[model samples]
Target chain A: MKKSSGDNWDSLEKNWREKLDSHKEEVPAAIWNQIEKKLDEKKGKAVPFIIHRRQWSWAAVLLISFGVGWWQLSNPNALVDDSKMANHIQTEINAPVQHLPNTSTPELEEISSSTNPNVVSHSEPMPSHDIHSNLNQEPRNTTESIPVIEESKPNTNPVILADNRTFEKEKPASLAKEESVEMLIDIQPSQANNQEKENSYVPEPSKKRHSLFARVVKQLRQAIDGEPVDWQTLKQGDPKLENSIHQVANTYIKTEQVVQRTFQF
Target chain B: MSKTLLPFKSEQELIQACQKQDRRAQQIVYQVNAGKMMAVCKRYLGVGPDAEDALMEGFMKVFSKIDNFQGQGSFEGWIRKIMVNESLMKIRKTANRYDQDINETYDIAHPEDAIMHLGVEEIQNLILELPPGYRTIFNLYAIEGYSHIEIGDMLQISEGTSKSQLSRARQLLQSKLKELQA
Candidate 1:
């Protein structure tokens, strides 16, 4: 007998082959229509692409960005009024000029006096002798140190307390440290009432205010800023008037001899 | 209207049409040899969507590389090799070629013992159902007669891995067929 395509040779492969062969033979008209349509569609738009200066992908990128940017700009919340921002800046620009330590308090005299211990700590007898010897120096001059003594009617005002609290925040280190240290440095023992001292004591009136630092700060500010514009000259437009009057006669001294030779007999 | 419009009616015609950039000639070349190329593609791609991919892919190779056809051997055979190689290259892209030994130490009571009970259909179905990685290797080595090195080089796998994967595919395919027959 011939060597058969035997049953032992696996009918599974044989049947698979048959199935596929049949499928090839009998592709349905519908399937063929789909295939044809696919081919036709591919060829339908087969216009040989003509490219100019730009890349195709670049055009795609531009299209996407423009669409996105257009949508973003058209949104209602995208715009902001700049005038409001300007007004905010203007308000900040015109904010009040507040001096920190000028706040009022019942202890104002004592506080001002205590700010400088050097003047108040000088022996009173020495100051009396100097005042007597200095005949040219007036006792009541505006820059002289004045002495103040408190009378016995003490009052507690809420406004005074509030102002003291505000200015106390800016106290110098010696004033802010132990009350004993402050007392030891400059206090006259006669005014020490151990009874009233149990309560908070503001600086005593025998202290003298320090104006030297403030005077120096004023001078530095003037140096940096230059003298404030002279309002009278500015108003009159008279920049040269001072020089013209002061030097006119002096400038003609050299020319006088030449003028005499040319025009005098 | 032109006689060459039929595209690749003969090899001479194909060469002539190819020189003219005839799209129809390309199409005809594809249609004529698709079945044979598909057989080659099947050995490389195995049975699946990948085979379809390999089919289109090999056609492109056949067309693009047709210029290299020196008409040395049967052009159809040359064409078959290109399609086969194209399928393998695609498979190479998708598959790991390193030979994995599913049963390097296979204690398979016996390989024949597993397949003897099954009808051919059950076994072929088992093969069809195999994981793509194993099926591609099995088909390339057993049915298509590719050497292990050729399979490895074509699929980018080591020869040892290719041999091991085939052995495993056979064992697994046989075992599945056994289970089905019962």
Candidate 2:
């Protein structure tokens, strides 16, 4: 009888396994040498690629650090010291209200520019409207001759804080009242200085109430003329001043809207 | 100026040394396995640079991954599997040659006597003459003792395809054995 299927296949498989598995062919010795050289090459290539990636990572980190440092330095208020800012606000609240000197618009510009070097004078075209007629009557200052308001601190050189962009929000109500009072004092000099007649005479405070309204009006006019405004005080002040302030503010807004519409066309 | 080399005390010690990338241990391991691995490569790739290349690549893998061996089964078995896989990879690179159809067929019968009479190289040469697909399937199934399922997985073919290729290989080998016997 023929052997079972399993037995027959097993014998054949067994015979081949015995012959081939035990068999050993001679391997050229040079093949091992080739393997060693290739392994070395792979190690050589791998090390540098990892180091190169690490170097790139370090470079990226340093570049980002340098960029952040440069940005903070260029932006003056980026590293604002809270204590110094509080001190500046305190100084503005306590500072005495000085009278505007008897001087011309050019003289005011000269005084402002002489007082603060950080102030950048930029003369934007003022919109022609009834609201700004008072400002229009005055001689327009050239781009280089316009005055920027600076932080009026004693002893230290006055620096243009309003132009720093954070001045309006951080400025207290007392500071706004003082700036409005001081602006009126500055503008009244042109008319009052003529009464003085002597160029050498210094200006003194007049017991005049109309100068307050003029101060508020001129502040609104200055805002419409592209100077920065302390809108915080105007919006959030005592309700008693709101009516007069809002009426003038509305006129300024309407004039600005008309100007924008004119420019769009 | 050369340094003296010491032989490993035992197989475990030898494996540990190879794991540490000891050059002497690596050379000794290569010397022991190279002949058997070369034989396995020649069976799949035949006697040429392809066979030699597979042998070199296989040994390199064995050394590189020696730490992973973990004393699992026989070390020689582990190395032989690597050599076989390396040869298969070389076959796959040529791809077209490895899947060719051997159209000729013969009856399924035992050639136990002829296999017994033939020398090792003669039987090897006979297996080598089969098409790459047939040869690979035959070596994997008959000599390597792999199931048709295992062969299919190894060569990325279906079990049925592996069976058919193995059948064709056996028929061709039997015919060749008869021709030699005649």
Candidate 3:
């Protein structure tokens, strides 16, 4: 076998390269069709990417807004304000009931309390039967009852009376003044007896159990009202209330820690 | 039709229009270069629909990667290189499908003057008669003017293998040319 030298191949390559240079064949028109179709396919793919990006941006915005709303609702300070409002209402309702125990003739006290303090002190004292007659007329004029109490309190400290009137006005219109007066009359002694029994009982567990039940009821009511409940406010009353508040606070703290851990992911 | 009347006389303007994806500019560019690019594809692939497929794919690559052509070399040369690479890829795929090696040697007597009498189409037919691997290396080394080392690197073979393949390809072509001349 003979091996060809590089020069022999170089000359052969030169002839082929020159001959092939002028050899141009027309490209089939079908190739352009295929190319155009492929280009269209690529364009189709690009459009969906843009649409998906826009969709993702909208989803991100919605998620951020929902997170902010959840944060606002879960804030503890909003619950504190609701608890304070509940405490104020409780105090006002208890005031009239507390004064009930001091009077023997309840009808006289009701009639006299409704009048001006100066008028009650200065005018001739009304008979017990006449006070009962006034009480019978009281139910007929429920709307005028609150205004009469306001007008009769002129001799008292006006600022305190004005605050009371504003508080009274803030109460729901569905709770009639006459109904409240009747409720006060009915519950006064029972409330007094309950207070005495609560103070006399030295047994810690029974008292604690009772207060815990009351705190749970109150917290559930606050939760229903879309408010945050403050377990700290429940700490001021009974030893049981304090214990229950501490237990609730510990549970809340643990739950919050769990939430924080979950959110970290 | 009115848009087609616009002048894109220079290669720079045409490339810029192609970069901007002007269809008319791309079509004009395709029409101008397709003939020569097809010729380059046919050299490796021979006269077949496979060469046409390679030409379309090569042009598509040219239009897509037109931004990469930095005007350092001739535009036609860059396009020709892409066509050659596309042909090599197609050849590689075909070689894999058949699973044949170019190490099978052919015995032929060298006919020095016979090739000169053969037409270009006859010469192309003779080259296509060689096996895929030999045809690829021969086209790269002889017509495309690549060295044995470059061909070795491109095909992942040793330089010695490329040289041996090219030798066999030349001998086969010489014999085929001698037959045509007779």
Candidate 4:
């Protein structure tokens, strides 16, 4: 038996090592040819493993980033920054409110004036608190079909409105009559109601009660017509009220009955 | 026409070109290491298509993974390790075919003078004559310089089996040496 440490065993390993260290057989040319072909095939097929691994990592990172961005967009209010939210609320509070003219239909004016013809009808601009101005702008062009007084002829008979009220052509010379001036009628509801209101008017409470009813009716009209009540014109009468009332009405009021109820007070 | 006319002056330059996947540099790398790697493969598997396959596969790995070589060791040593691993993989499938009983002993003769006189080809032939299991253990122990414990980890066998296989391989090789001398 050959002991592992025996000289013969040691010599056997040593000789094999010394001889084979310098001994190299010739590799066949076909092997290199095959290897070259395989390298080419591999090059054509894919990138190196390191680059492949890098690309996958980048793809994963991009996918995660996109997922986070999509989540943020889908739930926009969930991550509102406190400072930005405060800035937005402050801006809204400081912004001035805008409004449109509170205009009413000529039909309501004709009814009031015909019932109380002795009520003086003038072309002067109506007051902001004028009950007729409490109604929203009438259904657009409801007054266009109404005949307007001719500015050229001062002596012409007052144009008869839908309510049979005469629209007097008296004018202040400085006020220019615009072709599309919106009309506002000032007429007593009826001789009896006007007398009663004049007698029992308790200035503050009566005016407040009347305004509250007008506001409620305006809201209902707005709800039904899908139009906002032009409260600015309610606070400040139509800026162009001094001009001609002959211009075709621009805005709409859907319910004539609502307009009638609004000013009946 | 010869496809490879190597312009790289140093091994580092060749390795860099291979990292860049230059075909001529790859060919030069294959040409330079193929013969020694084939000899290493043959020591384990003998001269056959299996050795050729191992040689081709080892070079393929070298080119594809060239970027991993960070100048830590000799390039040839790294390649030799790859070739050895490829051979071991080819051997693992048929490992059960030649597993003899450890108790089956051979009377090892004193063939020190004969082993000393043998040429490289004769020593290689002697190792090839061993059973596949014995041949693997002997080549790992003798030529590759792996300890039996390392061999056990590599081949997934017990240290005792590695030692027994190596001892049996040496006894059989010594008997062959004595017969050759006669």
lDDT of 2 by residue, A1-265 (tens): 9775446657877877988887899878789898878777867887886677646544543444344344434543422332234434555664554323221144334444455444322232223352244335565332112233332324333222222123334444544664543333334456435633542222223322134344555565566457997744653433333444554456446654554455345
Error of 2 at A260 (Å): 54
lDDT of candidates 1 onward, in order: 0.47, 0.64, 0.63, 0.61
Give candidate 2 regions above 4 Å deviation: A4-6, A46-61, A74-77, A80-265, B1-6, B97-107, B112-114
Candidate 3 lDDT, B83-155, residue by residue in tens = 9999988888776522333555555454576666668877677777898888888888888889989987888
Instruction: Supply every candidate's count of residue pairs whose N, Cα or C atoms clash at under 3 angstroms.
Output: 12, 1, 1, 10
Give lDDT tens digits, candidate 4, residues A1-265.
Answer: 6454456676768777877866788888888788878877886666575466546544543444344345434544322332234434544554332111122234434444565442223343334344233234353232332333334334533332222222223222232222112222222246435544554323233443245335434543464456865544433352222111111011112233343344343
For each candidate, the DockQ is 0.04, 0.40, 0.28, 0.34
Which consecutive 10 residues in model 1 chain B have the weakest lDDT in total?
A: B105-114
Off by over 4 Å in 1: A1-265, B1-9, B39-49, B92-124
Off by over 4 Å in 4: A1-5, A47-265, B1-6, B97-108
Please give the TM-score for the first chain of candidate 2.
0.27
Q: Can you write out model 1's per-residue Cα lDDT over B32-147, one digit (the tens) per residue?
A: 56665655555445566676666665655565567787778776667767766777667567755444544362333233334445543444456667776787776666655578
Task: Give the top-scoring candidate (DockQ).
Answer: 2
- The digit string of per-residue lDDT tens for model 2 on B58-147 reads 999998899799787998999999999999999989875435434443457855555676778787889899988889988898899899
**lDDT ranking from best to worst?**
2, 3, 4, 1
lDDT of 3 by residue, A1-265 (tens): 6555566667778888788766777888889889888877877887887677656544543444344335434543433343444544654775463222222243433444454332232123434464344445434322232222222434542111111232244434553453455333334466646754554434344444455445655664475356997766676654433543454445444554554454444
Worst 10 residues of 3 chain A by lDDT: A157-166
